[model samples]
Target: MGYVLGLGGPYHHDAAACLVGDGRVLAFAEEERFSRIKHHRDSRSAAQSAAWCLRQSGIGWADIDDVAVAWNPYWPNYCDRIGDAELIAELLGPDARAAGAPRRLTVIGHHLAHAASAFYPAGVTEAAVLVVDGSGDGVSTSIHHGSPVGLRTVRELPYTQSLGWMYQNATTHVGLGDWTNAGKLMGLAAYGQPRIELPFLHLTDDGYHLDLTRYGLPPFLGADATSRYTDFSYYRDLKLAYAKAFTDAGVPAQPPGGHHPDRMAVDLATSVQAALQQAMLALATNALTLTGTATLCVAGGVALNCTSNGILARTPAIADLFVQPAASDAGCALGAALECARRRGDFTVPGPRQAHTLLGPEYSHAAIETALAAAGARYSTPDDIAAAAAHRIAAGQVVGWFQGRAEAGPRALGARSILADPRSTTLRDHVNRDVKRREMWRPLAPSMLDLTSWTTTPHGPAEAMIVAHHATDTAHEQIPGVVHVDGTLRPQRVDPQIQPTYARLLREIQAETGHAVVLNTSFNGPGEPIVATPADALASGARLGLDALAIGDYLVDLTASNTTR
Candidate 1:
C-alpha cells in the first residue's frame, strides 16, 4: 500500500526513475524521452521527469512513503574530492518535500543499488553480486554476497582503477563519442589486434592499480589529476604508446578510419573483449571465494556487456546469473525505490518480472486513433494492422513499428522498433544505409517469439534486447541478417503475457515467414531519440527510407511517401 520512489545518475547517461508499489515495479522510464535530450542531465530536467512518474501513477508527491537516492553522500572520502555538504543537499532537494521529510532518508551506495537491482529481482536468495560501470557514486565496481539477511559488500574497486573507464577512454581514442558509442567500439574491436602497449589492469589483495606510466601517460597521477581534466590528451598519449607497443608485440595498430585486415580487427576485438571478461570473472571468483555463493546477479552499465555476462554464467564458480534489463544508471531508480521499501519493512518480493522494459507508458486504442486522425493518416483495427505489418515484413519490406509505451533503456524492444525480414542478408545493409545511417559494420538485433524453438543458447532473462549471447548455428543460418559477425544475437524474447500485441505480431510473422524472429533495430535515425509519438513515427518513417509505419492499430502508407520522396 506504500509507494517508494527511486532516482539515479541524474544529469548523466541514462538518467531515470522507478516507482514501486508494495515491492512491485509500477512504472520505470528514462528521462531522455521527456527532455528530448540524449541523456537528461539538468537537475531540473530530472525533477520534471520524476514529477511525471508521480503523475502517471496518479499519486501526489506527498504520497511517496520513502525516497531512496541511488548514491550515498557519505561514502568515505567522497566529500573530499567533490565536497560533501553541497552535493548531498542538491540531490536531496527533490525528495525533501515529502511529508515532514522523514528523519534520516535512506541513501544507498551506488554499487549497492546496482547490486540490489540485479540480485533482488533475480529470485536468487544466494548469489555473488558483481557491479561494474564507468563509475558509480564513489566506486567503479563492487562485489557483494546476497542472502536472507541482505546484500553485504565484500570487495570494491575504486574509480581510479576502472575497467569501464579504460574501455571508454579507448572508445573515445577510436573516434566514437563517449557514452553513446562504446558499443560501437566493442563491435569495431572485433576488427583490430590488441597491441598491448601497456599491460591491461589487474586486481590484487590490497587494492586495484593500473600502470598508466607504462602506457606512455605521465606516472599514475592519481585521481585528482585525471578528474580535473576533461580533455583526452592523456588518452591520446596512451594510444600512441599502444601503437609503439603493438609494433613491438608484432601486432599492427590500425590507424583511425584506415583500412585494416578484418582478421586483425577481429583478433584485437577478441583480445580486449576477453580481457574484460577475464577481469570480471576474477572479480566474481573473488566474491565467491569470500561468500561461498554459487549464483550471481550483475548490474551496472557494464553488465549490459552480454558477452562478459555469458562468460560468467558458464564459469564453474557461478551457477546462475541475472542481469537487470535497465542495468545502467537508469536502473538506479528501481534500486532506490526497493531500498526505501526494505527500510520501512514494506518491501515484499513481487516475484520475478517476466517483462522489464515494459514498465513504461502505454497508449490506449482511442488515444492512438486520435493521433492518427489528427495526423491525417489512414488506419485499421489491431488485428488487420498486425497482419498487414507482418505481411510487409514477410515480403522483405522494412516497417517502422511504434506501439504502446516506449521502452525505458537504450533498446527499442518491440515498442519502438524498425523491423525487417531476418532471412534477407541485404536487410542489415539496408537498415544501416537507409534507416539507421550509422556504421555499416554495426549489426542489427533480433526479436524472437519462440526463442526456445531456435537452437540459440538458452535466452537469458531479457524482455528487452540488453544482453548479447551467442546465437545457435541454426539461428545464425536462419536469421543471418540479425546475427553479428561473431555469430551472436542480442535477442528480445517476447512473451504473450508481457506484450500481447507484440506476441500476436510475432505469431503472424511466423505464420508468414516460417521464422519467428524479426530483424529489429531502434526506431530512429542517427542522433535522434527513439520516436515517442505517432507523429514521430510518421516523421521518422518519411525521413528514413521505411516501407511502412505501424502505430498501434494503424498502418500509414509509407510506400506512397517513399515514392514521392
Candidate 2:
C-alpha cells in the first residue's frame, strides 16, 4: 500500500494537511491548531500540521509515495499565484530530498478535489455532487456526477455570480462580521423576517446570479477577498461599498462590531439567508435533474452553512444527503489526498463510508499526565472520567471535556468540547458571555445520543453537525440551550459504535438528568483554534474559566486552587 500526503491553502486561509494510506485517512489537521491562530491567515503553509501527521502515522517523508496539492496552477482563468507544491517542497527541506524522498507530486483541480472528498467517502454507488464556495480557480460553483469510477463536472458557474459573495457582503453590511463570520449572519437571520428585496441577487434557470455592478460590490467575492485577507485598507474600502449598497437598497447599514443587530440589520441578514436558501435549492434541483440521482453529496465552503443544508434536507428532491464535515478549505487537503490515492490505483471504487471524523493525532495517558504535572494542576484520577464529567455538567458547571483522538473538522464532536447543562435557559448566554467571550447571538449545538427524539425532520446525516434540524416541542422545553431563536438546532448525533467514550458520557448524563443531550461547543475562546494537545486543553480551561477539565482519566478542577491536591 502506498501513502499519499495532501496539503491545502498556504496562500488561502485554513491551511491544512491530510495523510491517506491505501483508501483510509490516517491523519488530518488544520494549521490553526498548531499555530494558535484563527484560520491561520498568515499565508504560511501546513508544514507543522504535515509534520504532526507524519509523526502520528509513525512515518517519515520517504514513506509518502505521492504528494497531492489542492490547487491547479495551470488554470489559465485566475491570476492569483498558487504555490502549495513549492510550500510542501520547502517543508520537506533539502536534506529529505537528498535522502531520496518518496516519488511524485500531483496537483488536482480545486472543485474536483472537493467532489472526491464528498463522493468517494460517501460510499454510494452513484450521486450528484454540489460544490458551492467562494471562488476557487475563478469558478464559484460547480455540479458533478459521481459513481464508483469517478466524477464528471456537468456544469460550472463563474465567480461573478457568486452566492458566497452576496452572503458575505450582506454579512459585513449587517455588522455580523466578515467572510469568516457568515455563520453568525445565518444565526442572526432567524431573528427577523425576510422583508427586504435585493434586486442585484436573483435566481436564473440553472443557478444563481449576482449583479455586482448594481450595488457597486466587490469585483469578485472570494477571488479579491481571499487575496487581500490581511489588507485592512481593502476591507475598509469593501465595507464602505457594502454600506453604500445597503443604503441604496433602503436599509440603513449597521455599524460594525455591534453586540446585537438592529431591526434593519436583522432584516437584511434574513433577506440574504432566504435568497441563499432559494438559490441553493434551485441549484440542487438542477443537479439532481442533470445527474438523475437521488443521493447528493456536497462540499466546499458554502456546504458549511448548516441553515441552508437543513432547508435542502427537508426538500423532497434530495433523498440522501452527505456533507463533508470539514467542508471548508481545510477539507481540500483531505480531498486532494483522496484524489491522489484514487489515481494511484490504491483507492478502489465504492470506497468506505466515513463513520467519524476522529482522525487527528491522539495523546496517551502518560503524555496527559506529563502535561498536567508540568502545569502543576490540581486534579484527581477519577474511577470513571465520563461519570465525573457528567456529574459536573449536571450540576450546571461548564466542564472542558477532552478525550481520545481530536476531531478533524471545525465542530467539536465530544473529543475537544466544552460541556454544559442544556436544560438551563440562561446557560447559553453565560457560556457565550463568560466563557467564549463572543457575541450572545450565536447559538451552541447539542451532542445527542439519539436525535430522533429531538428533531421533527427526517434523519439523514446528523452524525456530523453539518445540517440543522427543526427542534420538536420536547427539545424546546428540555434542551433550550442548543435550540436557536428559530427553533432549529445544529446537532451532532453521537453514535455509540463510532464514539463509544462520548456515548458513554452521554448515557451518564442521561442517568444524571432525564435528557440525553449536552450543550457542546468547541473548546476554545474567541478567535482561538480548537484545543489539540493536553497543554492546549489545560491552558484553555484555565484561561476560559472552565469549572473542571476531564482530560483522559484525570479531572482537574479549575475552580479550586491551582495547587495539586
Candidate 3:
C-alpha cells in the first residue's frame, strides 16, 4: 500500500523503473535489460519498463499515488542550452503528464535525483553526497549534505570543467570506445605516466578548481577544430586526441596490443588517477567541512570509480560510505521515483533496499525448456548445476552462465556472465583475444566468495568492481586468472540473497579447488550485444570460445560441436 512508482529515461539512455512500498524496494529494472540495447532510448522500451513495473507490483498505473520521472524539463535555462524542446515535449506527452496530474507531479533536478539515489538507498543520514557524471541537466558534478531535512547542495561543478571528461578523453586516445570504454582508461592508467602536469587539478578556496588552459584546449573543442567539446560522445573523442597530444609532447602513447608495458603509460595513468583522487578528496572534505556530516552518499557515473570511493571511505572527513548499485544514469529512474515519494511524505528518510540487482525479470523453468526444445539443443539437468559448472571451471573450461533475475547495473554479476577458472594466469589475455575481443590491456573481474577474505591492500574491497583492489599475496597465488597486471582484482562479492545461484556456484568451486573465485565476464561476444534472449545465448555459444551454456536451469555443452538445432 505504500508503493510508489519511479520512472526515468524515456528521452535518453539508461531508462528504468522501480516500485517501492513500505520503505522497501519491491521491483526495479532497467529498460536496456528488456530491450536488449546497451542503453535503452526507444519510447517502446521505456514505456514497456514502466508498464512492467506496475504489472509486477500488481497495481494499475492509475492506482499509484504519484509518478516520479527522474528529470524536470522545466528547469530554468534547460531548454535555452540543450535546445531539445521537442524531445522534452514528447517525454511529457499525454500519458506521462496525465500520471502527474491531481496527485501533484514532483519534478526533481537531475543532479539532486542522482544524489538522492545514492544517499537514500545507502541509509546514511549525514554524509557528503558527491554526484559526478558526464552531464546531468547542465552540471557535471554536485556535492550535498544528506539529513532528515533532505539533501542540501554544498557546491556545483559545471560541465565545462569535468574530471570525467579528462578520463573519457584518455580512453579514446588509446583507441577504445568512449562511454563504454572509460573504464579501460582507468585500467590502462595503471600502466602509463602523464607527461604534462596541469595546474587545473589544484584545490582552491572556491572549492576544487581546474585551470582549463593548462590542459592545452577546452575539452569541448570540435575534433578537427580544437576548443569545442561536444556531448559525451565527442567528449570521448577529445580525450583520445589529448592522449595523442601527450605523446606529441614527448610522452609515449602506449601502442595498442603491445605486449611490452610502457613506463610512460603507467606514469600517465598514475598522475591522472592521483589528480582524480585528490580532487575527489578535496571535494569530499569540503562537503563535510561545510555540512559537518561524517557519513557520505555518492552517485553519478564518476561515483562508479571504486578507487576514488575507497579513498573517500578512508578519508578523515568521512566515517561511512554508501553508493547505489545503479549509480549511473539507470539509477535516475529510482531517484525520480523517490523525489515524488518525498513530496508525498512517503519517503521520509533513508531505508534498506529489499533486494539488489535481482529485481529484474525472471524466467520460469517451463519457458527456458520451451526455448531449448524449439532450438533442438541438448541440455543437462545436472544433480547440481552450480557444482557441475564449478567442475567445468576447475578443469579450465569457460562457461556462459545465465540464471535467475538479471543484474540491473553494468556488471555481469553471476547472472548473464561467462565464468572461468582464476587459476589460469593467461586467462585474462585469452579472454580478451579469444572471447571478449577487447583490448588486451583491459583486465577481467572475479566473483569472490568472501570479499573480506581477499586482500585489498593499496585499495580496499571493490564490492561493485567500480574500482580495482590489490590482491593479497595469498589470493594472487590461488587465483591467478582474475589478477590484473598491477596485481589487483576488480571483484564483486556475491551476496547470498542478491546472487544465490552464483553464490552456490562459488561455494562449490571453493569446495573443489579450495579457492572460491572465477574469472567472470559478460555473456556476449565482441561487437555483439549482451545475450538477452535464449536465442541470443545459443547464438553466442555457437560463435564464441565457450565450453558450455547454462540458461536458467538448462545446461548446454558447446564443446560437443553439436548445433542447437
Worst 10 residues of 2 by lDDT: 76-85
Supply candidate 2's per-residue lDDT for 221: 55
What TM-score does each of the candidates earn?
Answer: 0.87, 0.93, 0.86
lDDT of 1 by residue, 1-565 (tens): 7988787775345667788888777888777776667666545225545666787899876777776777654444443122333443454444644423334445777888888887777776677788888776547788888776667888886655667877665554445555566677667664555544336456554334555555465543566445433344544565566454444444454445422334544455556666787678777787777788787778888887866766775676677667787788888888777766766666644346335576777677787767666666654454577788999899889999987777877788899999999887887888887778887887788888766655345745545676667778787777789877777777888878867778888889989988878888988887777777676787788789788888877777766733321
Ranking by lDDT: 2, 1, 3
Better of 2 and 3 by TM-score: 2
Off by over 4 Å in 1: 41-44, 73-105, 192-198, 203-209, 216-268, 349-354, 459-462, 562-565
- For 261-379, candidate 3 gives per-residue lDDT tens digits of 45655565666677777777877777777778787777888777766776776665567666776888878877777766776677777566323566666678888887788777868
Residue 356 displacement in candidate 2 (angstroms): 0.9
Ranking by TM-score: 2, 1, 3
Reference-based TM-score, model 3: 0.86
Pairs in steric clash, model 2: none
- Name model 3 segments beyond 4 Å from true: 9-11, 41-45, 78-105, 205-207, 214-267, 353-355, 456-462, 527-529
